[model samples]
Target chain A: MEHLPSEQSAAVRRIVAQHKERPGPLVEVLHAIQASFGYVPEGAVPVVAEELNLSRAEVHGVVTFYHYFRHTRPGAHTVSLCQAESCQSMGAEKLAEHARRRLGIDFHQTTADGRFSLEPIYCLGNCACSPAALIDGELHGRLTPEGFDELVAAKAKPAT
Target chain B: MTTTVYVPGDAGALSVGAGEVAAAISAEAKRRGVALDLVRNGSRGAYWLEPFVEVQTARERVAYGPVRAKDVPSLFAADFLKGGTHPLSLGLTDSIPWLRSQQRLTFERVGVIDPRSVADYVKHGGYRGLERALQLSGADIVQAVTASGLRGRGGAAFPTGIKWKTVLDQSAPQKYVTCNADEGDSGTFADRMLMEGDPLSLIEGMTIAGIAVGATQGYIYLRAEYPHAHAALKAAIAAAYQARYLGADVAGSGRRFDLEVRLGAGAYICGEETSMLESLEGKRGEVRVRPPLPAIKGLFGRPTIVNNVVTLTSVPWILAHGAEAYANYGMGKSRGTLPIQLAGNIRRGGLVERAFGLTLRELLYDIGGGTATGRPIRAVQIGGPLGAYVPPAHFDTALDYEALAAVGAMLGHGGLVVFDDTVDMARMARYAMEFCAIESCGKCTPCRIGSTRGVEVIDRILAGVDGERNVQLLEELCETMVQGSLCGLGGMAPFPVQSALKHFREDFRARV
Candidate 1:
């Protein structure tokens, strides 16, 4: 099963066992498999359908309902930065421009070297410290062009 | 230990270099041999009091007005720390009407506690709801939520209890609670504030949801926009797991609920429930036609209850205070408090959580103190981009969804963006179409190609493409997009366009 990758292959069996019992067992199973591998690979759709006793169309429909699921591998580091009014008020748009120019990537694209990936986050709750950005789940506040360079450099250095 | 911070917590504070102000506090304290303990707490929500540094002595935290780092030395010599009364002192920090008057429940612990400290969270009444939830049967927990009347705060005011009940009735062995933290509206920052200020409330709410619905897992569908909220959540989650509030066991209750935060790309459409599920599963964010609502079918085709950040965050308060305590506060059918975001050219821009019956006059005039420009306020757009444009004539309308809808507007997330006379309504109208066009997922034709053509039509109208004919064309396109679109991006995009055209017809005429 380790070689089987994610628990997605068991989705059909899992759903079938629980489908008659409840209406939304599908969302649960999908979340489980996705949590394990970071993304839900396609090979498990039929497994989900067979288990839930729902048509493939029905199962696919559920997977397509929300935007949280991922079918591909995300880069090593995901950088989600604020683009809301409060952040924009503090020149987040310009900071985003600097980020795009420096990282050589747009809002959602990963870099060629796979060193970092950028994601546009709406509000990081760090409005008190506006123009906030997160690198690999670590929050950085009061970001400027100079601050951005030092932080990105720190994130990219060898762990050892 | 002994330092002063005049944080306005208003967007204006950050705008006018409060960041440098914060840095200056650190450097100045080190140089002066004074101790500085700076906390980036939530906005006291007072805009006029911005860059307002407060000095904490033994007795009280004294208020200092709009002090620049350039004036720190003079402030020190003036014995401002001794509270000897400087020219800039605004008296007491908590005495300000904006800070003193709010009956903050959802935002109670925020800006006052360490966001990632589980101990601080528990000390501040964080996981009491989860503990209460574990003691009750799932049905009983659902009853508590139903009685609270907590509705989705991400635009739509759908009752959260009904959504949770649908998933609860589903007998699926697997279930999921998805928190939609993708707050993309232009003038809103409440979600980010809650996350950074008091993250544990959200975690506790999700945990309670998991126990109430028998779901073993939860996911926070955070937008790519908030890097700070994401980090705070991640650190808080790790702390929860270590403290046994999360992970396999869930604090010795043996309920076995685990949570993971999945980050979104820059897609705004994903904020929609179904589209959020698709993107969470790692696919392009496209709207799904609902027969299987996320309550019946969501996330990975399992029974999932998708809720907004406020919807989830408010759960702990409801469970702790009981349904009636919350239900008694609001005016009409709109039960409980709503977080109102004031932004743009407003005199006082910040977040205010209040009971649901405040009027636009009260919001803009009394609380917001009108527009900052000192110019005449032309229009106010409530509920973010999807909400209607309220001309000054309509400012007296109440804030309830039904009432707002009656006035051709909706109380969508209660984001009020103030625009002065200088704002070009025609340009704003055109930009609305452009935003929809760029952000549309292209799954359906009305939202996809229609938005692109919308840009062209608006541009043509601006360029004087047959006066009457162009206006007719614009109206026709808006109707099609509204009636035929698959999701909100297309369905609600016409609101701003139609509103601008209806109220400010002269602007369009001038462009033509």
Candidate 2:
């Protein structure tokens, strides 16, 4: 009875069509939807379910299960801090606290200015250089509180 | 001759300013009018020396590292292009003691070759295994793997050959070979390194598995946390398809095998094989019961061969070389080499691929160069978040599966995370439960509910509110999770907590 924005609906249909022939293609479809929109909009779920011949609950269950899927619109830049044991061994907890205070937002929260969003990642597979973080998909290792501030500040400045 | 330079595009290297170093070298070399060819290679598994740049000389590759962007001009002035001496130069990279002593079998071409080049991978003995497999029957291939004694490198230590044999024996219309590239374990990067370094080997390995198990379609369940690995795998897979190494008629064998890489969002439990298969099916990452194991009924109700990236990658070597060649290395039943990832608070943290007989002390001190802080080595959490906290007393124990298991520790994926004297045992113990609680897949009662209670018990013990009793309760809860949980996630999550209680009882007492 309801519909998404025409453009988003078309994109979702295109993604589902590409993967519909493959066995168990719903996850791949969801991944494509998220990649296009940065987050799976609430409007995209029902469209995906209908196109993929799955229930709405089935679609929503998967979206909520994994921590990586974003439900809300992210800020200009997304920052993910590794909160696993390896990072914790090298003071990742303190680093996380520092980032929270610096960004003025806790994990899973966006800044008021919409410049940054923070999330806690399990691992980035760069444990050799512990206390790692990903700012807009670029990983930074051996992250200290000071280095993190410098990185955030550097990114905040407007490009020439 | 154009001077060839290598700056690792390995994510670990890129993370610590290697990208900036590469840019500086490019700009500086252009200004100096030096003709240079820059090849973005993978890390040599030496974290301490990264942005470890190498220059090709007639003798060997000359290494200079921990190189910063500012150091690029000085490196150029010092005639590093000609392998001239510099303060940072380690001269003849292979001669470095850290990398020289280890046996790098699975990681043979990791830092040496261009990851996306099929020709480079082939020149370095890449598809020889698939070549050998095409000439043999599926039964014979399974027999060879079984004879090699190759076990699962995904922490389960299940016999890989037996898993393949099950899939081979099963009568299915559509069997599949699924590589568990979901390397979500903390303090482990061997899978990432291999994927980013020599992805062709993994592709070859999967092809061989498909040939053995009669599987035409394969899927690589890669974790999304490693966007760098994802990019490398995607590019390499395209190259493999172009070269006729992946799609139908692989290597002109007429036996079809198509491989695809599916990304897992951010679930840690999906590292488990059944959970991985469940996630692959577009479901919540809930663990399936194992009456009809994944070997029999997996991946869309067909027989499946689910293996770790290392295990499948190890297959090419086992097939290329004789089973005896692989079986000859290591101690006892744990045959072949393991890519041991030394991480966390270690001075020379990197990957050390060696036979399984090396002791924890040798790894921590000799290879790892002890704690990065130069303080006393207090504890080392072997495996990952699900592994045990090995004390200094057990440092003499061998790293083989049986040997480590004897000491109540499992060599789960060969990730050893070191800790210095400043570590808080109680807090570390609390974190183990907290991590379990956070990541538990909520299918069974013991795992989903027990983890939450275990955290509360640890908090109560730490608060000294009837500390001894709460500690006992924590132990009881750990036992329940171990015996009652459906999968290894809950079953082994209490290992660190139990080990902490067993060895660092004094720390808990002090906290109380």
Candidate 3:
């Protein structure tokens, strides 16, 4: 087992402590841990399981089951393209292809430069404006290949 | 006198350019020294007019839209703050033909109120239902809901009052009320809109439900994708708690109702009530078999009242108005207005809350203004991933549950996703199986294995490899999956594929 980072361990402990009183609070704990660290660290699972009084297998089972939880550290920004029906109707597939080629990474893979990670999202409830993507947390819709490129470039720029 | 300006903070509007428009309006107003209060209201369901900016006049809120950041200065120059006549100036917000003609009971206050404000929410008839619910007996409240003719708006047309009465009748010491806000349907945003736009109504509805069903604890299982809605809900929930509408001693009736928002981890199956219950319990969102319906045994094995956001939100209106008054709208057994979302390739993609009898043709041509591509509309997928691809030949079908079911289609979640002539039905058919394969919980053999085979068979037919045999095989596989699957995720997944084969078979055949 890997050693848990001090801050991550502390954050996980705080989250677990906060929600441990609520009935079936494992999911809430996981959400908080993920919020603290962009991804749920594998080492923290054992700690959470121990704190929540469940076996490590149970925690691992939940962590792996949901698509939203990431076992590893993600890139600086996660770009999720809507892969549902509405987005498909508005040329989402073509835009997704363009996104992959432009970023030099496939879905669920982070770019080597560590600026972005591409993922497929079912729907962001932005169906009215199709061809949608959620960059980090901000949603962009009616995206073209060119618009996507500009969006990524802008996000990649460091804050002054 | 200070002018009150309205800009939508709705996700759809924000996706376009509402944020920039709001900022520009603020900056221009500050630069020109115009006294004004900018309120970020929800969308009016007319997305074609978004970034729709409205100015509150004595008569009504005047509207302008598809507004850009650059258009702000020009709009001000045109004296838009005073409801001046500009090219984009749409006269009263409610007078818009698309919004005016429809019946909006559940969504009456959606775009009209400041979502985060408790004061604003109350000012617009928010807590009338909860107040009324507090006075009535638990059984009496359930009876009123029953008489209102309300059903589950979550694609499943199960009667809402019946579900509540079951829970109300349950002898369980620990009953719960759960709002299934996990709206993963591709073309549906009514749930999200309601939660974001008029969250207080949903809060009030849930509170009333807790009072009616004798349940103190409530959980809203929301999808992770809707961050904007999440923020709005959190803020509104806190405000609701502060105002004493939620939490212990709700409205000082000595009833304790505590509400929490639980996030679903990107699983479409979680939208399924049983699966949603499972997710809320901090497990994999696997569907639980029904015997003891959710009303009997659910959410920690309690008699839980599991309702969709729309179904629960409709409670406030039903309780506030008399049951007969609420039942006055709509036709046939489906006696209520449905918030039909016109999405996908439609020109005017937005939410349309109307009486449950509008024709598909009226929604498509008259309301939506045809396809966004301006091409001839070929098909429309009502409901989400599991819904059928309806052909134009059946456009005259009335928008009711039974009316749609008669035509081998469903009014699932009331989302009408339009598709232009450019669509290939074969590809769409493949996506149906693929979506099922990706989302199925693997508890059932037919759904777990059959969906994969369905995809492969569709591919073979698409590739023209013994196309005729594969098409027959695909149909057989769809039937098997439909009969053998555990839940709606697998059961209804075949609807799209079968509908495609039935309505658009030419697109299924090999290129010849």
The prediction achieving the highest DockQ against the true structure is 2
Model 3: CA > 4 A from native: A1-3
Give me the chain B TM-score of candidate 1.
Answer: 0.94
> How many Å off is the CA of A87 in candidate 2?
1.1
lDDT of 2 at B316: 94
Tens-place lDDT digits, model 1, residues B202-247: 9999999999998998999887556557777898888888999897
> Per-candidate TM vs. native?
0.78, 0.98, 0.98
What's the iRMSD of model 2? Answer: 0.8
- Backbone clash tally for model 1? 65
Report candidate 3's fraction of native contacts.
0.76
Candidate 2, residue A12: Cα displacement in angstroms equals 2.6
In candidate 2, stretches whose alpha carbon ends up further than 4 angstroms from where it belongs are A1-3, B509-512
TM-score winner between 1 and 3, please give it: 3
Interface CA RMSD, all predictions: 6.7, 0.8, 0.8
Q: After superposition, how far is residue B511 of candidate 3 from its true place, in Å?
A: 5.7
In terms of docking quality, model 2 is: high
Sliding window of 10 residues with minimal summed lDDT for model 3 chain B: B503-512
Query: Which candidate, 1 or 2, would have the higher TM-score against the true structure?
Result: 2
